[model samples]
Target: MTAVPVFLYHAVSDNPPRWLAPFTVSPRTFVEHLNMIADSGLRVVPLRQLVTTLLGGPPLPPRSAVLTFDDGYADFASTVAPLLAGRGLPATLYVTTGALHASGTPSGRGPFPSAATLSWGQLRELDAAGFEIGGHTKTHPQLDTLPRTSVREEVGGCKREIEDALGHPVDSFAYPHGYSSRTVRTLVWETGWTSAAAVRGPSALSSNRDDPLRFARLMVRADTDRKRFELWAQGEGAPVAPFAEGLRTRGWRAYRRARAVTGHPYRALPTDEG
Candidate 1:
C-alpha cells in the first residue's frame, strides 16, 4: 500500500499561548522538518491531489506528502506562509470562522484558548497567496458530540461563511479536535465538503485507500523531533489509514458524549492528542 503522509500543524511560533504550546512548533524546528522532507526525497503536494487520488481520480506521484494547518493561527500568516512560499510548497489552511480575530478582538467566539488568531484580512491575503483555505467550523466544537441541528449549523454554516467572505466555494473541511462520528461525517458530506481531515491518534498516515471524508493525518507537534519526523517522511513509523475504529476510541467517544449530556463535555483544549 502506498502511504501518503498528510502532516497537520497548529501554531508555528517560538512564543505560543500556554494552552497552545503543546501543539506549537518553533519556526526553527519547522524549517528542520521541511529540510528533512526534502532530504527524504518526498514531494510536497497540495491536499487536493491526495483527495483526488483517494476518490479514484488519479494515482498520486510516488512518495507524495501534504501540508495542512488548523485553527488559523496568526503565526501562519506571519511566519509559516513565508517559509512555505519560499520553498514554493503548497498547503491547505483550515480556519475556525468564529476564532478569527476581528474588530480589535484578540480572538472570536470559538472554544479555543486566548491566542493571536488570523484576522479576516490576513486570511484573504493568505488565500490570495495560493494557500488553499478550508473550513474548521464556526466555533470549533466537537461535531460528534453536538446535536444534529447544531452539527449542521456548525458544518454547513462554516462553509457558507467562508464562501461569503472568500467569494468562492471551499471544498475541504477538518473536524475540530479530529473528532467525528458516522453522523458527523454524513453531515459534513451533506454540507458539500469534498474532503475532511482527521488525526488518527499519534503516528498515523493517510493512504490511497483512506476515506476522503475522514482521511487520516499525522500531527507535527512541539515534541515531534527529527527522528520521528524523518520516520514519517519515509512512511516507516506510522500505521496507514483504513483501519477499523478501535474499541478504545469508541469508549472514549461514549465518555465524551455522556459528559456532553451533562452539559460539561470534555474540553479538548486544541485537540485530543491521544
Candidate 2:
C-alpha cells in the first residue's frame, strides 16, 4: 500500500493575511487544490480507514489519501466543510476540547486573525455529516511543556469530551502545537487512544509502518502552496518527520522567548518532538 498524504489545514479564506500564522487557503485555491487532488487520481480516504488498514484493512486505491484538519477551526464549517461536501469528499477534524468552550481570544503565534473554533454542538453536526472528530488536546497546550499527568489530561480529556458530547468514541489524536515526545506518545496510548498524529510529512502507510500512535503528516501551513502540496501528497518533499523533531533546536524562538521573559534556561525541553 502507498503512503497516504494526510493533508493538514488551519483555515480557508481569502481574507487579508489569512487571520492565522499559516493563514487560510482562499476558497478559490482550496477548490483548485481539491480539483488537483481529483485530477491526480488520489481518493480521499477517511482517517479511521487508514488506521483500520494499518490494523489489517485492505489495500487502498493507488492515489488514496487521508484528509485531516487540525485546530478545529470554525471556518471548517463556514468555509471548508461545504466545499468538501459539494465534492463528496470525507475529512476528519481534530479538535481541542477546551477551545470548544472558549468564547474569547485565540492564543499562539497566528499571523492571521485567530478565528473561533468549533463548538461541541457543531462537532456533533460534523459527526452526523460524516466527519471524524479526533482529539488535539484539552486546551491546545504545548504537550512537551506539560507534566505527564497534564499530558494525559490534554490527550485523554479531549477524547472523553468529544465522545461525551457527540456520543461517539474519538480514537484518533493529533498533538497540540504539533508538539510530542516519546513520553507523550506513551501517554496517548495510556489514555486509550487508538492513534496519534504529528506534523511529519508524507505518510506512514506507504511503507506500512506499525506505529499507530505516532503518525506523520504533511502539515499544510502558511508556506505550503498548491504545487508543493501536490508534490507532498505524492510522497515527495522534504521529509517532515525529522523536520518536526529538529524543531526543538530550531523552535527555541518561542520556547526561549518564554524562558527569557522569566530569566531561565530550557531545562525540560527535549530534542524528541515526535
Candidate 3:
C-alpha cells in the first residue's frame, strides 16, 4: 500500500508580502528545493496523472509524486514556471477566478495580493506548456460554511470559467485554505471535477484506498529548509512534522465549524489576519 506524496505551494518570491510570509518560499529556496527533488530519485508527475492512477487508470512508476500550486499567483508565471519549464516538470495551478480581475496590488490579506493573480494569457500559456489549470473557486471561499448552492457556484462556476478561458476541461479542484466538508467534497465530485485537494498536514496521504476528492497535500512553506524538505519529499517526517501543524489546522477548522453551527458567522473565506 504505497502512497504518493503531493506537495502544495503558494507563492515563490524573494520578498513575500507580510501577510503571506508563512506560505511564501523565496525563489532561491525554491530552486534549492527543486535541486533536492531532482537529486532525490522521486519521479514528479502532474496532479492529473496521480489522480488517474489512483482512480485505476494505470499503474504509476515507483517513487512517484505530484507537485501542485494553489492560488494563481503572478509570481508563479514570473518566477516559478520558468524554473519548472527548464526542468521539464509539470505542475497543477489552481486559480481563483475572481482574483484575476483584481487591481494588481501587492501585499494584502485578500484571496491573493493585488498582483498575485496570474493573467488569463499566462494561464493559457501554462496550459499550453502542459501544466494543469484547475479551479480554486470564484472567490476562494471556505466551502464548509456556504450553502450547497453557493458551494456549487464556487466549485462549478470556477471550473466552467477556467474551461471556457482555456478551451479545455478543468478536472482538478482545490479547496481554499485546505478546508472542506463532506458536502463540499460531494459538490466537488458532482461538479464534474475528477479530483479535489485538501490539506491536513502530514496526516494526509494519497494511497489507492484514499478518497480522490479529499486527496492529501503536504504544505511547503518558507521555513522548509533543505533538511526538512528532504524529509518531507522522502515521506519520512509525516508523523512529527505535519502532526504538529495539523493540530492547529484541525483545531481551527473545528472552531470554525462550531461557529458555523452556532450561526456566529465566520469569515466567508480565509484571511491573513494580523
Pick the lDDT winner.
1
**Model 2 worst lDDT window (10 residues):** 265-274
Q: Could you give me the TM-score of model 1 versus the true structure?
A: 0.97
Residue-level lDDT for 252 in candidate 1: 88
> What would the per-residue lDDT of candidate 2 be over residues 48-163, giving only the tens digit for each residue?
87778666767655667778887777778878888899989998888876667433444332311245666667778889998888888866766766667878777877777888
Q: For model 3, what is the C-alpha lDDT against the true structure?
A: 0.76
State which candidate, 1 or 2, has the greater TM-score.
1
Task: Output the lDDT of residue 124, model 1.
Answer: 86
Q: Which regions of candidate 1 deviate over 4 angstroms?
A: 103-109
> How are the candidates ranked when ordered by TM-score, highest leading?
1, 3, 2
Task: Give a tens-digit lDDT track for model 3, residues 1-274.
Answer: 5666788888899776676778888898889888888888878887777788758787777678888998888898889989999999889998888776434433333466544567777888888988888989988877777789999988989988888888978789888878777788888988899998887653354554456777777788776677877876776666321222346665777788788779885763232210
lDDT by candidate, in order shown:
0.90, 0.67, 0.76
Question: Given candidate 3, what's the lDDT at residue 73?
Answer: 80
Instruction: Select the stronger candidate by lDDT from 1 and 3.
Output: 1
After the best TM-score superposition of candidate 1, give how far the Cα of residue 8 lies from its true spot, in angstroms.
0.5
lDDT of 2 at 117: 66
lDDT per residue as tens, model 1, 45-153: 9999999998998888889999999999989999999999999999999999988866455663465667888988888899999999999999988888899999999
In model 2, the runs with Cα more than 4 Å from the true position are: 16-21, 102-114, 201-207, 240-274
Winner of 2 and 3 under TM-score: 3
Which 10 consecutive positions of candidate 1 have the poorest summed lDDT? 102-111
